[model samples]
Target: MNRRRFLRSVSALTALTAVEFAPWQTMSAFAREVEDFVRGPAVKDHPLRRISPHVWMIHSPDGFPTPENQGMMCNVTFVDTAKGLVVVDSGASVQIGEMAIRQIRKTLKKPVVAIINSHYHGDHWLGNDAFAAAYPGIPIYAHAGTIREISGMQGNLWRTLMEQWTNQATVGTRVVPPNTAVDHGQELKFGDVTLRIHHYGKAHTPSDICVEVVEDKLTCVGDVAMDRRIANMDEGSYVGTLAAYAALEKNAGSTIWLPGHGLPSGQVLQWNRELFEGIYQPCEKAIKDGLSMEEAKALVLKDPRVASRAKDTKGFDSNIGKYVSLAYLEAEAAAF
Candidate 1:
């Protein structure tokens, strides 16, 4: 998760969830040290798993970006389009992205025709520099809002944080924002494969767009449906996220869902839906019942499942408070 964005978004609620200090901030120095040691050249075998004849993905080990993983914590996907390859969500840094390209070359020796940015998150797009260098003039696709988010200092913010997190491993990783912007239902066909790009309003982020491969019967649902980690929804909408999951489920009949994180499965869409709704309803009720923010926070905090589930899963513990706060704000905004 982007720690800076998370801090900025919920800065107002710091006093409310003051039990935990700035955990991410406290680890910066240690993270830099780790990154310095582990930030090296890309490897050829980085756990690339095949889904079908044309679809394959690399599930970055679960947890925060570290030198050990070379900041390759986001799931990077590549679709073999026969003539060439199409990549979805580049790795977190230049090295990680380069690693993906090298790994892909092991089996599929096709040029990357196009690179798609699933969202504006730096982890998803910062690696664009690697692709642009390897495949010159390749068109990078994303939603207009995604372009806007990564255009200004936001991209730099991601880079700076990543440099610190990866011990300056991303020194040459410049931001190459998407050049082409696709609409809600734009379809692009390449070598007998047709990808239907979809923007389900504002779910995971304001600019999230999932890619559905028509022939492969697969949908790459960005951060809309993370596998086990508790997703950061500070820039997302509770209602819109629920609706997005519902829409994804409605269309996902036997279609494999390759999420931005974790393994690919059609089941996680419903899992994420239940997770969102499970937290949302209580918060909404707390709001409707005129309970204080502390009461709502306490309600979620007191729940044994919320605490237990977060503790059992990696990367989910530190984010529960943030998700509850965001859900509360989303519920309040929807009410007005």
Candidate 2:
């Protein structure tokens, strides 16, 4: 199907599901429910908690607080080297990023020497400005395409979301771009630690790089292994995503997998493999059967794996249908 037809079909499916599932009516209620789920039963003094000795995971009490919210709680990793410190993905905003930096400083007082963006997603890079403001002249690293994509779209995305959510308006707000771009493989040595940056082309985004600290054996994967119900493929390629997972499995081994969201895991590759199989196989079957994206979504919904974690099965249908449409398009294009 052509892009226009495919988009129209997806829109129709969205509308159908929205009406059938009462998404609008339930949106507020569902948000409250999710808020409760995330907040947990007990009210802890510090919601933002530390995961490992060097890694801290900032939990968003309201989940995503604003439109500018990239649905990422910060995953800040502190590397103490003879030179200085190295930070992984910053939080969702400048404020949060600075907060994370302060939290990191509580442990170690070294200046941040460098930052490695896992991908071009706003949530991962929006906090770069805060880090830069705190420590000027610090070099940032990312995949070449990540810099281009974020530079092209970050301003608009930040503005649009800020207006919708925060009601604070400012134009010409520039996000700091990466100073160094890695095309394929590059090793960064900071005093005693060596970090291997591997670029997996066109995976979660046009440029997705996984940061591996060799000595620590910890791989900080940005959005590759979100603990959420489904993977967001809005800016990702289906085939490339599979290849990215394969590459991650080969390179990361069984070390700790620090994802952009949720608790850190040691079995990231296995989880990613399961996610791919759960979503892809059914999606392909639906496409081959000439079923509409909506039908494919329903079929996938029936899968026990998806059903087990589905927030609202009906609403899940709409979201999964869109992903199925994109994957189907990619699969069909590949056949030619």
Candidate 3:
């Protein structure tokens, strides 16, 4: 806010302060209210839809954060179990989480019993703040790597990036990292439903954890796979990701894959695997052929698997080069 506007607001709050209220407390609260008022705007309640027998999700239409999206660029999946509700990837920010809570109250009216973070990315777990506030001492779960990164620089770094991306829309968001650590092959039971945690080394990130709902035949794949969108392998491995897909297929066979950014379907993993293959196989060949990164990118673009989905992939034009470079490096590292 401008100096004049801020002064006017402070004056109004000062006038409203009551004798019973402590002067310092009222002033402190007013300072916070003023800071909140300047944020881009609160996100409106997003609609929730059921994707499986027990999983309901708020699918974010956008693929990345922007002022327009208010940092609501990740899917908020709710697992309705016999016990209560288990949140898979809380959401992007506190505002987004609050919106999810609104939908929960309107639809299921169930208490959020637990939260599982897919990775350390802020968009996947920063909403832990809202849930923690609403359900005090809620058990927030994640992989050991995820917990470590989020508890360190990744937490504040993402918090700042979200604010910058949303132009202060996510200003009030806090970095509330997961409190509990889960690992591969861990099964968490919530009444009748069972959540099986699967972590096959590193795919999207070392911390990536896909939660499989055994009874429902569905798995929340986080960024390990996305529908109609290329996965970010910046902090990942193409060879490792393919291995993960193979492992996941063998274990959670034929289950619906719910992504953090797109629609949930049985074909999600296959689609992303093909897309990554299109991007990485070409790079792998190029590296073996002694070609440069630029040549590798050319082959990736020409690959039918990549070409066919080019028009439909979100951020394909702007982000493909970076992802191609990442794949090329991974391919080179593997070859060496």
Q: Choose the strongest candidate by TM-score.
A: 3
Determine which window of 10 residues in candidate 2 has minimal summed lDDT: 37-46
lDDT of 3 by residue, 1-336 (tens): 844457556765664664346587776777677656654456898899999889999999999899788998999999999999999998888889888998999999999999999998889998898899999999999999999999999999999999878877776777898999999999999999999999999899987999999998898999999987777787888888899999999998646989999999889988998998999999999999999999999999999999999999999999999999999988888887
Alpha carbon lDDT of residue 55, candidate 2? 46
Regions of candidate 2 where Cα sits further than 4 Å from its true position? 1-63, 67-74, 166-174, 311-318
Relative to the true structure, how large is the alpha-carbon lDDT of every model? 0.78, 0.64, 0.89
Q: Candidate 3 has what TM-score?
A: 0.92
The CA lDDT at 185 in model 1 is: 77
TM agreement with the true structure for every prediction? 0.84, 0.76, 0.92
Count of steric clashes across candidates, in order: 0, 0, 0
Clashing residue pairs, backbone N/CA/C < 3 A, model 3: none
Q: Among these predicted structures, which one has the highest lDDT?
A: 3
State, as a TM-score between 0 and 1, how close model 1 is to the true structure.
0.84
lDDT of 2 by residue, 57-166 (tens): 55543333343443334455555667887878765555556666776677566789998888876667766867898899889888888887777776457535633443
Winner of 1 and 3 under TM-score: 3
Off by over 4 Å in 3: 1-40
